[model samples]
Target: MKLSTNYLGTVYQFSTLKEVLAKANEEKSGDRLAGIAAETVQERIAAKEVLSNIMLGDIRENPLLNPEEDEVSRIIEGQVNERIYQSIKNWSVSELREYILHDDTTGEDLKRLSIGLNSEMIAAVAKIMSNLDLVHAANKIEILTKCNITIGQKGTLASRLQPNHPTDNVEGMIASLKEGLAYGIGDAVIGINPVDDSVESVKRLLHATHDFIQEWQIPSQNCVLAHVTAQMKAIKQGAPADMIFQSIAGTEAANRSFGITASMLEEANQLAKVHGTGTGPQRLYFETGQGSELSAEAHFGIDQMTLEARNYGFARFFDPFIVNTVVGFIGPEYLYNSKQVIRAGLEDHFMGKMHNIPMGVDICYTNHIKADQNDIEDLGVLLTAAGVNFIIATPMGDDCMLNYQSMSYHDVATLRQTLNKKPAPLFEEWLEKMGIFENGKLSKIAGDPTIFTR
Candidate 1:
């Protein structure tokens, strides 16, 4: 393929598909740290021009990571709808982007179009799209999946109520849980990132959250973010769980670092379907982020954005209830600062939607990063505008256990009101029944956690 281009009369050349993909990416500290990013803005634009002209079939045929060597590559390749792919194989990446943005391309058309796309193609189009382009195209599609209640319906936003306690204290967690419920959050799931990964700790948190849901008749799901094996063991010991939770990466080596394999994920999925508490065909929950593979020393010379898209490709196999990117939690080495974080958040959401997964985002950042709650709050609003299915909500946008700031429970209520969106349909019904929401706004009693005491 022609990998040379001229930008402003300067010749720019990249050596391989992987190099072109990496250099074409928006400025990311992670890619630069990996020594893969283009050295100049003009060079980056040159790479984008070269990439836009490349055909979808060429990207598919020239695998960045060989399927024979990487299971993630294999799984993604194995699932391609060959007939559909053949039809679009000759289209340039620029044509694909224009087709998606065309006024006549309906959400259903995008859904069908997703079947023919591989992860690399998704990442390629995203690389060339402007930030607003990402938002507008992603807003055109809606992806809804069910766990206990459905999420991702049109004009609906959901939140994962994260009541993390540093010591796995059930009462402290319940206090936070009650506070989140007071604001009409937790429609997506009451997911906890426990300080302890022990099966006992995981089970204890799962049972606590599950019992509270039953007590209040809340229309939500519950999950404890532990290692997949610990969650599996807890399920075997009869812990009440609505879904299985695991953090996945884009490469087989990276997944191994997380102590997971395709087989392991499949096994956990089957167990959740047979034994977990949720009522559905969708019961798996996955969290992915940019730069995870690099952190684990398993990036294999590919850019982080492409790696993140590979995550969704792998996740689609099990028909997950929810899959989200922890967009900025990996620190500044990967994303750098607020500008990078915001750009990555938009790109990740758009790419995930392009993969046709029920995608959400943990719009978050670490203290060390040059980002604050205000930056993520801005992202929350943008994602809400983009029709993101859900966002991670913590008490006052602070997670004491994970030591990061996310969107607050109050932020969830605000975004819904500000944007003329509502919580999930079943969740809104429960909110009305409990008098927490009324007349399309939070009621007078909405912020009172004590109401649940009665």
Candidate 2:
């Protein structure tokens, strides 16, 4: 048949459908390749031939094409599954507790094993472990389940105020802040991606965000989502360096597209240490996602999810305050639909948590895709169950400037209620002091519809 196709910008030629199928079954083969093989074979071969082949060979149904239940079971029984089951099953309660708490190697290995298991299995394992062991394991995995960062002298769940402005206008940004703060959001940090990437524009936004926090006496941090170099300029210009932000990728070249170098990130880290808010464990704020390496043409034939995990390796170098896998923000080219998006989100979160990176997820989707708020809610709940550190709380879950829908402030409050979770410790205290929260419950202010309306 002489079928030639491109996967991640590399072209592979096969003389027949059988050769394509063989390559698709190779270890570490990408889902894209397998999808391509299936489509090509279906096109060239008769239905009976394909059905016969499927029935006779060890070829399994494409998990993506199957229903959710079957897909999950397939994953839990895959190669990484038994390794995880065996690893945890072989250890006694005390021994598992000791290894999770003190053995860094085993803790990380467990995280790797967890990549293959579903949320149900992960939760089941958590149930089996003791409270102390679970807490220590969560800490080792850098899960921000109960830890609070000191913001405004009150404890709060690490959260972000993502108020993206279309024109980088200072007034528009201030309006967004007023709205977000009015609703008891922005506990983690209030950061914006400026439409204008200029030094002066970034400096103006940074100063404005900082002044809003100070004038209102808010406990949250602020940042301008500019390049590291632009941020460096703002910092040198005396702008408040609360947290330096960047979009990092797995490969050096992919990161270069964003104008980030390892040295530059290190410099930003040092600069933040001197001039930024030292409220949290680390100062840098990084966002990554699956398939970004391939999207940037730097994947080197690696699968998107594996490439994403390698990006975490780069991110951990800076010891970031936050690392969010902006799961679906890259659009459908990389993650085609809700199923792919949800799975990628979980995989990225699980991998980051396992690596002990302070992991969060921007449960987001572009309007061009077959995804909606319901999908985000489903993935958000699952991520919460997995002890994800934080999520992007945008206004009404839609960012006009970024042109994507994300987790809204209302969504955050709903998840908290559903799971009986609260904000970061320091931020929660401030909320109570301000009467926004009463007796660990949301006060009237949190329910005021006028806040978003205004």
Best by TM-score: 1
lDDT of 2: 0.63
Worst-scoring 10-residue span by lDDT in model 1:
372-381
Best by lDDT: 1
What's the lDDT for all of these models? 0.94, 0.63
Single out the weakest 10-residue window by summed lDDT for candidate 2: 56-65
* lDDT score for candidate 1 against the true structure: 0.94
Off by over 4 Å in 2: 1-157, 279-281, 447-454
Off by over 4 Å in 1: none
> How many clashes show up in model 2?
14
lDDT of 1 at 296: 96
